[model samples]
Target: MSITSFSFPTSIRFGAGARKQVAAHLLEQGLKRPLIVTDRALGALPVLAEFRSHLGGLDVAVFAGVFGNPTCSQVMDGAAAYKAHGADCIIGFGGGAALDVAKVVGVAATHEGDILEYVWDHPQVRAISNPLPYFVALPTTSGTGSEVGRSSVVSENDTHLKRVVFSPKILARMVFADPELTLGLPPAVTAATGMDALTHNVESYLSPAYHPLCDGIALEGTRIAAAALHTAVTEPGNLQARSDMMMASMMGAIAFQKDLGAVHSAAHALGAVCDLHHGLTNALMIDTVMAWNYEAVPAKFDELAHVCKVAGGGAAFVPWLKTLKASVGITGTLASHGVKPEHIPRMVEIAVKDICHQTNPRPCTAADFERLFQAAM
Candidate 1:
């Protein structure tokens, strides 16, 4: 086995009204000019306004260029905004897309060449040796857990192929995880994003990695998500449910430092090829892939079943996922979500090439990916 490293070092202030501390914290650090990186829709919402109201003393500029799946172009645009406003720090606001883009905007602003040149797999990937502007995160959605992530996933503007810029340098300096920020999420968005958090916990736990610490976090994260996801979706105003889901989301992100599996590979492929929401793709593909994975790690599945309170142990785990999906109103296949049969081959190619599946308990081939997509459809 290869040597592994573990870290969970992000400073997090988790509770209701945590967002109110952002301005004072930044001010104490002497950061007066801050750029707010968020999605256009969220920028127009009362949430953004309320958050800004807390920063009355700071000079803040808004860059609401992020939308849908994040793209390299969006990062470039945000960098331009950062430069234009002479912003000394970044405040990431909104869900995963906005936060992912926010993570890399500082990289582009400080480095030469296009942001894509900094992707980890680039032939001449740029080193991030310069100090990045101080960045803090406030997530308005309890999914992806991008607030605590050390990497950013951005796609090519024209190709829609995803690329990753993986570096500890991009990790937010602080995270204000206020569940109150998520109170206005619609039930459908809540369901899909909650499933994403669950998938991260589930896939990381099932990964064939030798990180016991991550495995413990993943199992507990799975338990938290399983207990709160449905209630979070149905009762959007339930602060306790929102808080649990938020914690589960961050825990999933933290645990996945050990790595992920086929579900993430497949979800990344769907995000790239079908332009589907990452969470929805995960929700659609998780059970299908897990069904195929069950035989490889029955003991792990049994543990998962115990955590989720599924009866009949390992054999019941996949069925429990299916039931959970339906209960959350995520009822349908990939085809129903607008993924076409013709999309399978391209998605398979992408999934096979993704780094995430290398750690899957059950090894996946191109053929296996094709079958998973078809079965998911």
Candidate 2:
């Protein structure tokens, strides 16, 4: 196996009311003005009011147009907003969508190039700019760990092609994980987001990389999601379950950064064409991809036997995934997610283009993606 350097994490502040301290944190870091990038749904007066108060008139500005599957144009718009506001830092304040958008804005606002030029595997000889102002994150949901990650995924508006702008400069200088902020999520939203975390764990554990660090983190993340997703889904008020799922979600992001594989590659493609929620799409496709991965790494699946071992003693990850999917109300397939058979060819082409595809334990051509999409359907 080839050796690789593995970086650990960004600074983090946990527990309730951590968000209330954002102002002081920024003050100590010497950030005078910051852009708070969030989603429209979270921009509602009632939602943004308290968090806004946290900034305490430190010249903080808001740019909440960020939507689902953050697009290149949208990220550019965010970059524009950051420049217009004379912001010197970023505060990501919503789900993964908002987090990714903020990360991109931080990179693009400072760097000089087409955003995709810096994407994984994209051909462009561009270098990062000087220390890109700092970043602080307050994830309103569990996470994609946009706070700790070195890259941010954005979809192209013209083609809806998902690409990532990867660099350690995009990582948050500090992250605030506050459970109280997630209490308002609807049941379906909770389920979808939780399942997205599960996908990351599964993908990370199955990654072909030699990083045993990511493997252990992914395995424990999977266990936490399995133990807590159902409770978090059914009983939204359960604080312990909520916190566990949130931590698991961050761990999912950390683990997958080692590398995500076919599931993310396929999900990114399907998300573009279907205009589907990434987490929900992952929920829909998790079982199919897990089954495909089963043949490639039965022993790895066997190693994860304990995660789903309760249902079938010493079972592979497949049976456990199926049982977990049904338990969390994620029994649907890609077809159920509105992916028609005719969509397979196009989705396949795009999936192969995704950066994550390279990390798949099994190398996939367009033909392989078509086969996976057909099976997913």
Candidate 3:
């Protein structure tokens, strides 16, 4: 067997009022100036104001320029804000896009050249040798679990293709996972992001990687998500349901360290080509890709079905997912979401090139991706 290393080193404070602890945590560490990196829409919300109220003695600046999908420009722009504010720490306080940009803001602030040059695939990837800002994450949404992630996915400005900056150095030093922060999410956003969390667990478990640890975490995460996603969407005020989904989301993020599968490859492709929300793309394509993937890993499917309590085991798992999506208000296909048949070719090309599918239980050829996109449509 080949040598493999594993690490799960994030400090987390999980509860209803966990966001209140961020100020104290930073003060104890002697970080007085914090730049809160968030999306424009979230910045305008009362939740951010409430969070700010907790940081009474600290100097805080908001960088609310992150919007839509995260991009290289956003990371660089955030770095500029960091320097302008003379921020000594970073407070990532939104959904995936904002948190992802926040993760790398320190990299851009302290390093040379474009932030894209630090992506794992860059030919001469820059080293993250400098000490990064003290970073903490408070997730307002449970979908991407960017609060706990070690990598950031940013898109190119012109091409809009996604690029990944993978490194342990950029990982949040701490995570304040407060489910109350998610209580006000719109039903649609909750549903899409919930599905995104579920997809992460499902795809990570299905990946043919050799990490049994991730497999276990993925299975448990699937069970939690299956039980709580609909309630979390329908009754947004139910803190218990929200909390379960949040924990499940973090578990999915942790589990995917084993890597993901073709579903993510397809989702990334859709995000790049169609500019669809990442989670929504995953929700749209999950059943289609899983139906195709079932034959390759029947036992894993059985395990998933068992964890999710599907009556007919592996054969019923895909149907269960379809039902779950419908229950959470994630209806319609790729075409219904404005994807055309003409978009399939470009999405397929991008999917085949995405690294996530390399560990898929079944290998995906360009032809396979073409079929998947066509079927999803």
- Model 3 per-residue lDDT tens digits across residues 1-377: 11122235788888888887888889999999999999999999999999999998899999999999888999999999999999999999999999999999999999999999999999999889899999999899989988889999999999999999999999999888889999999999999999999999999999888999998899999999999999999999999999999989999999999999999999999999889999999999999999999999999899999999899989999999999999989898899999999898899889999999999889999999998888888
TM-score of 1: 0.98
lDDT of 2 at 375: 79
Which candidate wins on lDDT?
Answer: 1
Give me the displacement of residue 176 in model 3, in angstroms: 0.3
Shift in Å, residue 313, candidate 2: 4.4
Q: lDDT of all predictions, in order shown?
A: 0.94, 0.80, 0.92
Which parts of model 3 have CA positions greater than 4 angstroms off? 1-7
> Higher-TM-score candidate among 2 and 3?
3
| Prediction 2 global C-alpha lDDT | 0.80
**Model 3 weakest 10-residue run by lDDT:** 1-10
Q: How would you encode candidate 1's per-residue C-alpha lDDT over 1-377 as one tens digit per residue?
A: 11122236888888888898899999999999999999999988998998999997999999999998999999999999999999999999999999999999999999888999999999989899889999999999998999999999999999898999999999999898889999999999999999999999999999988999999999999999999999999888899999999999999999999999999999999999889999999999999999999999999999999999999999999999999999999998898889999999999999999999999999999999999999989
Candidate 2 root-mean-square deviation in Å? 4.5
Once superposed on the true structure, which residue ranges of model 2 sit more than 4 Å away at CA? 1-7, 313-316
- Residues 83-156, model 2: lDDT tens digits: 99999888899999899888878777887876776676676646676677788888877746566677788888
Q: How many clashing pairs in candidate 1?
A: 0
